[model samples]
Target: MNAIPVDDDSLTWGVPSRRVAAFFIDSFLIMIVTLGFAFVFAFIHLMSFGLLRGPAHLVLLVGLIYLAGWMASPAMATPGQMAVGLSVRRADDLGRATLVQAIAFTGLLYLTLVAGVIWLGVALVTTRRRAIHDMLSGLVIVRAGALEPRPW
Candidate 1:
């Protein structure tokens, strides 16, 4: 994807609090959609095989689901994000980076979910209020169509 040129007037980072609110809504929506999609796929696979798959297969499948969402969602220039006035783009305008980079970031995100939650804390403190995954993925979530930012 070509980089959306960041002009001097563009927000680039410091997006307002409302954008953060919209991000949460988008995230919840993605969760619902992805899970629904995964379940349907899993059911079909299960029925065809007439046996339950191992946890490993399920984990791989789920990872693929997320990766596909991550890749395809942004394929539209913007995704559910743009619909709600947000965009996900690389920090350095390096295309979409790579799948391995995205997966590694996701791994760190899940690992942080284990006990200490340090990465979660990092997300809370981000300049644009990006989640750990977003930061790691080098994607900024910003208001899509608005000119001026909402009041702080």
Candidate 2:
């Protein structure tokens, strides 16, 4: 993806609060989806007489992949992030993030959340309002529509 020139003014405005709200919204949505998957997996396991072991164990991994997939898509935002007017981009050039970066971001984000949620405090001190995962993955959270559309 070509790097897009983004103004800090457009990228950082009111993002922190929007991020918090997006987190809650995403978490709720994830929970609902996970529950649905669990039920399906349970049914499969029963039908197989417990021989298949089903896919219950992969739920968490699948959730992470789903989040990463969204981050790397043309939309560059999870459903919740899109709903809340936020997008994720490469920190260095404001380009679309690769799948690897998105996966790293998703993994690190869960780790940060698991680690007492204190890591998020770093965003308060950072100039760009970026969280630990955002910095580690070389990604940034910006306001939706902050990036110009690709000409292609």
Candidate 3:
């Protein structure tokens, strides 16, 4: 009697075992840096008699946050990621993403967020356990100093 072979697809990727704290830490750290840009924009608006203080300010803040998270993710990863032992990397390439690449990811992430369900799809997928924004940006959040490969 011949036996059929089986293939396990779960071994292809890994999801970091850390709890949500790392995600929050990375987000908060990026936001703090982005706030600096917000303040500058705010101050400039203030000098102009509050012309840009409301909706315009909010739009600028969101954009600044995206830019900060994308561009400085690697820099912040050295420390902020070190704090939670998590780091961000490109998914398919599995290497340090360039600043421009990161920025592009941020822009695409905004586009992906138009529908809330897309984010859910990202988190639910079997590939790397990332959010839709991550998928759109070609990025992954992984353990920083981990040595062993995950069995997925």
TM-score per model over all chains: 0.50, 0.89, 0.54
Question: Which runs in model 1 stand beyond 4 Å of their true positions?
Answer: 1-52, 55-60, 71-80, 115-118, 121-136, 146-152
Supply every candidate's count of residue pairs whose N, Cα or C atoms clash at under 3 angstroms: 1, 0, 0
Superposed on all Cα atoms, model 1 deviates from the true structure by an RMSD in Å of: 6.2
In candidate 1, residue 38 scores what lDDT? 70
The candidate, 1 or 2, that scores higher on lDDT is: 2
Per-residue lDDT of candidate 1, residues 32-111 (tens digit): 76677678768867886945555324544454446435644545222444555554455565245355655555566556
Q: Candidate 3: minimum summed lDDT over ten consecutive residues — where?
A: 3-12
**Per-model lDDT:** 0.53, 0.86, 0.56
| lDDT minimum window of 10 residues, candidate 1 | 71-80
Which pairs clash in the backbone of model 3?
none
Residue runs of model 2 more than 4 Å from their true location after superposition: 1-7, 148-152
C-alpha RMSD in Å of predicted model 2 compared with the true structure: 3.6
lDDT of 3: 0.56
| Candidate 1 structure lDDT | 0.53
Best candidate, lDDT: 2
lDDT of 3 by residue, 113-146 (tens): 5655445455656555777666667766665444
Candidate 1, residue 112: CA error in Å? 3.4
